[model samples]
Target: MTGIDPAVRHLTRTAAQMRKKKPMRIMLLAHSYWPEHSPPQRRWTTLIREFRKAGWDIDVVTPVAHFPQGRRRLPRSEAGTPFRGQRGPFGERIKRVPYLRHSGNRHAARLVDQVFSAAMSIPTALMWRKADVVIATAPSLPILVAGYLVARLRGVPLVVEMRDAWPDLARDARLVKGQVKSVVERVVEAIQRRADLVVTVTDGFAQTLRARGVKNVVTVTNGLDLEAVQLLEAPPAERDKLEVLYLGNHGESQRLDVIVKASALVGGDLMHLHMVGHGTRRPDLLKLAGALNAPVTFHPPLYGADLIARYRSADTCVVSLRDDWKSFETTIPSKTYEVLAIGRHMTAIVRGEAARIVTEAGGGDVVAWKPEAVAELWAELARDRGRLTAGLSGRDWVKANADFRQLAVQYMGHLSDLVVAGRSRP
Candidate 1:
């Protein structure tokens, strides 16, 4: 043992310490899981893989994969299996429950599906062996409720991971109003109160939860998976016409119609706008773009190598948010991180945290919904293409701060602390 290299010795000691205590079994409750192409699934999948590698026994409970497009993706043979258990990546066990499939881009329809999935997940979770800690990933309220119930029943600490602000986001988007908004706010508050720890994707979100009187909130911002980062090819050669890409969900919150309007403002032979992804608002956006004679081309979503290729092919990526919506101010779109990781220039049409990061990093220009301003920025970029390739401080910042391994370590430490504290209580 003494002959072992110092680094190896340190690693052995760390592994032994991790094994000194019985392996912690962590149950993750998420409405969407592996085989789904959504951001939340990607984030959790990477984290779960890391947790497993670190010797934690991680079990996942999720509905059959269906997201963004809202069509069930299970194999025909597995479609009828209401409650099926199978080994997932990294030796983690996964429980798939039946859920009502609905378009995730539509708020009301997605909420209905979430409720049904949550209902089915509760019983499935209760039947599982007790976990040391339960983590509920939520942009959906029902999943949080189910997680709370399972944690309570299992007598374990509950950790609520907020991917979005839920009721607050809905209310800001005007999707929930009047008495419905009041009720949702109350329910969200109640859910937060039940959580032994709250994990959020943004510091802004953590602050919002703290203001609502929820204690023990931690920010674990979305990060780039290093393995995926390594797979990205170098940015492709500049295209004949500057290809400006907007890749992500075309939901109401995204206010992608603003992009259409901006496209109309900048109609020229030298610029082309590519809008990729599916959403409830895609038809509306398409119709508006056609009516305005905007130079925008719409494409279905791409994943894996295809998506990375799309990024490489673009000179700039556009990210937008509804300017009037306060709830979105807290959001740092995962695409922003992706673009930075790929070292592509970006145009952030947003406010608050997202804008601050872009501005501070000098990643790209930040513009409002003003069509003229957006057009001006695009024209400027078109004239000075060098601006797109100049500074890479943003990419470097993300690589240094938002690496997945670093984020996973931070997340695991939080979970470990929570588990230890829970064990010490009573």
Candidate 2:
């Protein structure tokens, strides 16, 4: 409330009115939820609330979870546990399903988690009432299975939102091979083919789906929640020293070996590099930091009230993606949108949509994924401090166009079409 502009109040009210007519009974099913060190939950927090204000009833079905480390965290916020004292900004209902926690990067663990999630979810979906639409996200494909079953029982359309191109990710990551991968791949492939509509977060991913011959697919790129991002304002007391931040999962996909080497080249004391969040490669990165003698700090991911202030305080944020062919076409990491909103300059040692967005905004720099390139970019950023001041410019562009409210409007319209098509059937 403190930072919300009075002018936007009218727009919020208008969006709410349109939201009231044919309000959606949306059930978002995902493996990760709030407090899980994931961006989707935070985005969904704003998303669900906005739907509620617009007069829709929103419900979230997610696991009682922890992420990256696979540790189950306590639910201690005022909202309490989802089944009991759940409350938030927009008064949406939250339902938590029992799920097993395990590392996503390890092949054995991935199988275990996926199987367990699918098993637990089958019976768990019975706990909720039938909804108009069932929206499912993937990492563990069980949520899609859960949605399919629920949608079949309720006779509703199923929206499979693919956040990651799984089994593909597993294949790309070399987690499986030959007949084993083939059989599991077919299972996932069949799911995507059968979905009423398959939604992908990137155009590159959408192409992958089209090539596979799936119809009714759409691209809804992960976006900044403008209301939440705009609510963030610069903090008063930034240190004289530069604060370069790497926020989000630190995993193999980031090619952190170069990041660690670049940190060594920069000499940690001159600029502070803060890595926040947990991922498969965190321990290795920490070990690399020790060997390189870099000035780096690590912290757990922020949640609830802490998120806003962290953005306000960041001087510059960094995002890294490993150079790979499939990666370029398959993924747009969530941090890309978060850093854009922080109103800070961003540096990406990545290619694909992530770098394109940064360059188009004229906000930051993109370097080849190499140690020398990373070193050069860091040196360049260090020399041109004034350029950092303009980094927030991209954020302005995002506020006007790439906001979630606009995306939600488009998504709702798409859902209405699907609903109409369903009514016409047989």
Candidate 3:
């Protein structure tokens, strides 16, 4: 008995044929792009670059840069005149759409940025010509709306890639309410329905979209680029003490307080939790660590090779998703993949699909966002070094399956089929 899903088998066969004849020509629209330093931007970079390598002529429509580094990427300056345009390594054109500001904690600020980026994309995509396909990547749902309209105008097929679910996620988080949120959700749903193909990051999310009436959805798990990750050397373990590292943003959604509480509960050389990253909640988390006298170390963001090396210092990698159920179906922290790439056992203190990934990958253990549970797990792992080492077998599982190369190939195959179908249509 062949265990492959029929839909996937068919799509795979179709994509293989499309690749041999001619590579795809694709225009990807996202609010952020490479060097902006967000997980979504990182994912797009890997996929787009891989597609370009496979002979896809790619063009990325994105906003002017400014992100996790907290600095505006100045337009390239040559002598006195600024270099207004730059193309990606594989000759993919980069079209910078004007945007208002960087990320923000305030809804108004976030809306302003999202709207500006989307508005800028309208002209950007309209003026960009000769692409066989357009992919609207999301979280900024406005981009999907713009992609759909542009594709409709150009008579091209529009593919929507959902990185996060919108208004409902916002509603569940109590970020907004009343008529406006209701309206935004309806708009998002309409766009989802209109897209010819929808790419979801997880099966759980796809299921949610299905229940909400979205059709033609496919799951593409977030994965690590082991090629780049290999540049990082695993650090030598320091001692008998367990070093649990949490890498990525220290924002509110992480529910890091639980980790702090858990550490306080354990309170010994047996456990040490290090959080490495910058976020709005860092100061508060730092203060809480001090007040609680938890054995927590805070480090600033590290980039690429350096970041990987820094992460190697830990015996186990840790990630915490928000305790909010609203987050379960909508988000999967990309750090989980990074942890696997680094060959570290993961300790995820949250719920939903991420927990499932950890469990299935044999990557690590999952516990509810409870101090006692987290502490118990920490103590158990800390006492059992051999177990932690054995648990890292999941890293091998991820490398073979969830690594970026495999993911990129899958994505390009899907995009190729969409392009072929678009080209075939009357």
Q: Estimate each model's TM-score.
A: 0.92, 0.86, 0.88
- lDDT of model 1, residue 373: 81
Considering lDDT, which of the candidate structures 1 and 3 is the better prediction for this target? 1
Q: Per-model C-alpha lDDT, please?
A: 0.81, 0.71, 0.74
- Higher-lDDT candidate among 2 and 3? 3
Clashing pairs in 3: none
Q: lDDT of model 2 at residue 1?
A: 55
The candidates, ranked best first by TM-score, are 1, 3, 2
Q: Candidate 3: lDDT over CA atoms?
A: 0.74
Best-fitting candidate, measured by TM-score?
1
- What shift in Å separates residue 185 of candidate 1 from its native position after superposition? 0.9
What are the clashing pairs of model 2?
268-295
Candidate numbers, best lDDT first, in rank order: 1, 3, 2
Name the runs in model 2 displaced over 4 angstroms.
1-17, 76-89, 101-107, 230-242, 303-314
**Per-residue lDDT tens digits of candidate 1, residues 1-426?**
978756446545664555465667999998777777777788988887877877889888888777655767668343325687877767888888887766556677888888998999899999988899999988878898999999998899999988887667877877778998898878888988779999999899889888888889999999888547732343344546667899988877787887778778878576889999987889999999999999999989888778877887888899888788788889888888777777788888988998998887778889987777887888787777877872567767776667676687778778888999987988
lDDT of 1 at 133: 93
RMSD of 3: 4.2
